[model samples]
Target: MEKLCPRFEKAMGLISTRWVGLILFDLLKGTKRFSEMEADLPISGRLLSDRLKMLEKEGIVKRNIYSEFPVRIEYSLSDKGNELEPVIKAIQFWADEHIPPEETDDTDEQRV
Candidate 1:
């Protein structure tokens, strides 16, 4: 077996976490407020917050705070995050090729 490179391992460790990819992918569509992200992802608010912090630390996402009555905050992809577009697209392509479509009750279906 081949040994994994530490840098590669560390990079994977960050992105491989549950909900991280989905969060990144959602941000790819455009900037979104905290509430908007929560509504789109099925993850808990706490988890989403944690993941956003983590991604922010990694320079993959940007958080903007607006001074308003309630203090609005928006999240968007940083340049680094935008660089992951091809990577995400490749994963999406692979899934599309390998995974079978699920049988669901709703007409609107979503895939990661």
Candidate 2:
């Protein structure tokens, strides 16, 4: 069998990181503020912040800061990140088919 390429390995490393796939999946809905994501996902604010920073650095996510009294910040997928939509959808489909409800936690059901 052919060895996995470095690019594939790197991509897996990023997406397989805890919460990274979920973060990307959530952003697929639309751009969201940090607090919005915090509320949407079970992740803590600090860990979410860290993952956002990492994704931003990887060019998978974009961070926009609005110049306002409160300095609002929002996150959206970069073009590259948007390209993963089909992949994310496939995963969701697979889970729905193969992963029984009883095997998944309550939170997992609500996320879909």
The top-ranked prediction according to TM-score is 2
Model 2, residue 54: what's the lDDT?
Answer: 98
* Model 1 spans with C-alpha error above 4 angstroms: 102-110
List candidate 2 segments past 4 Å from native.
Answer: 107-110
**Residue by residue across 1-112, what tens digits does model 1's lDDT show?**
9999999999888889888998999999999999999988878899999999999999999999999989999999999999999999999898778777764322342366
Model 2 per-residue lDDT at 23: 94
Q: List TM-scores for all candidates, in order.
A: 0.89, 0.93
For all candidates, the clash counts are: 0, 0
- Tens digit of per-residue lDDT, candidate 2, span 6-101: 999999999999999889999999999998999989888999999999999999999999999889999999999999999999999999999987
lDDT for each candidate structure = 0.89, 0.92
Query: Model 1, residue 96: what's the lDDT?
Result: 76
> Which candidate tops lDDT?
2
